[model samples]
Target: MSFRIVDLAETGSTNDWIADHPEDGLWVRADRQTAGRGRRARAWTSDIGNLFTSTFAAPQPGEGAAPQLSFVAANALLDTVARWVPRERLSLKWPNDLMLDGMKVAGILLEGHARGVIIGVGVNLAHFPEGTERPATSLAAAGIAPPSAREACGTLAEAFAAHRRRWREDGFAATRADWLAAAAGIGKPIVARLGNADLTGTFEGLAEDGALLLRLPDGALRPIHAGEVFTLGDQA
Candidate 1:
């Protein structure tokens, strides 16, 4: 794996850049992403102190990663954070966000094509920035203070690489177990927001393929393959 760090970048969309490069195990990171973005094309503010990165993976067919590469990326991050922060303090907030003490600290977004998968990650290292619609957080604010951006990236990248290698061996079942160990709301009452409709249930953890197991109010455990779920927050 090779890493290329640029001081600044025009766009936060790593999937776009990796698509053109397609270099095996290539990583692109920018301290400032002028048009940093998130899921649904929301504005992702990339300040000089934050960590914004995108990585490319040479594709493999019949692997658990084809349609659900995001889970793999999330698991890698969870593993990485667990090494630096206590498991109790670090939690995988469903699909992709890495939450610490109930505030979002990092996020992963994956885009794929016939050739490979592009994994984009944004981390708030310094200030979480005010004026966001959702509550946000940062590593420095969460007691992992004074850590350099380069140091955090190096640690996270190492963890991600190991986690990803294991994922290729064990598939999503193994990934599900690893993710559950670090998830925040497991076994707790959680609400799944599905835009117009919402499902209230207890977080029963994850299924074999990474779908959520929500024990609904009716006491029936439902398998939810799609929907944003979190504690107290309405899914959108």
Candidate 2:
């Protein structure tokens, strides 16, 4: 069973709430998040009628890299969207950002715990904040039929459950293939913004542990651990 709330405001982040006020699977929806966040503390819009969801899972033992959870979560979002859109059109950006026709449709953030993992996912299901130069998308804007917030979150959770099971058995190799098959930019020139330092290189694809493979100008292959990467328009 899933524990859900209807009208919550901001309180730092929803993942924090799931950590302290633990539940089986808490679905926290806020009317307005004063300080909604994304990767690297970017301001996330929490406008009404959009999806602001976070799911906390009890941890399980695993052998592969721990950070593969983001891949699993990203693929889960893609899987859910495939129920409506053509799966071939879905692809994953560096990390777990979801792309459709090269524009960002949704993205995921995964937080780990001692006994469980809290995954915070924010999807632009309806609207986006204005003045944002970065391209943003919505489910309805993308031609997907509208559904209630509860229904959308439930659908993603169901899809995530199935992908999580595959992550347990198949390892990152299988995860990378699934993501690459639907990738928007596989081999192309792109710029990687890793904070601290930025590198421009050719986007080769994903490594075994989910890191992006970048072939620099020197003909040297670089494996990026985690960074904000932008695939050129051509790649997209």
The residue-by-residue lDDT of candidate 2 on 93-123, one tens digit each, is 8787887766787778777777667788877
Residue pairs in candidate 2 whose N, alpha carbon or C atoms collide under 3 angstroms: none
Go through the candidates in order and give the C-alpha RMSD of each one to the true structure: 2.4, 2.9
After TM-score superposition, the amount by which residue 3's alpha carbon in candidate 1 deviates from its true location, in angstroms, is 5.9
User: Which runs of model 1 end up more than 4 angstroms from their true locations?
Assistant: 1-12, 233-236
Model 2 misplaced regions, further than 4 Å: 1-12, 23-27, 233-236
lDDT string, candidate 1, 1-236, tens digits: 44544434456455677677777566777767767778767788777788777777776543564546677778777666666677788778877899888888888877775677778888887868777756788877877763566666676667667666667777777767777777888788888877678888898988777778999878898988776776855433
Quantify all predictions' global Cα lDDT against the true fold. 0.73, 0.74
Error of 1 at 39 (Å): 1.3
Instruction: Give TM per candidate.
Output: 0.88, 0.87
Q: Backbone clashes per model, in order? A: 0, 0
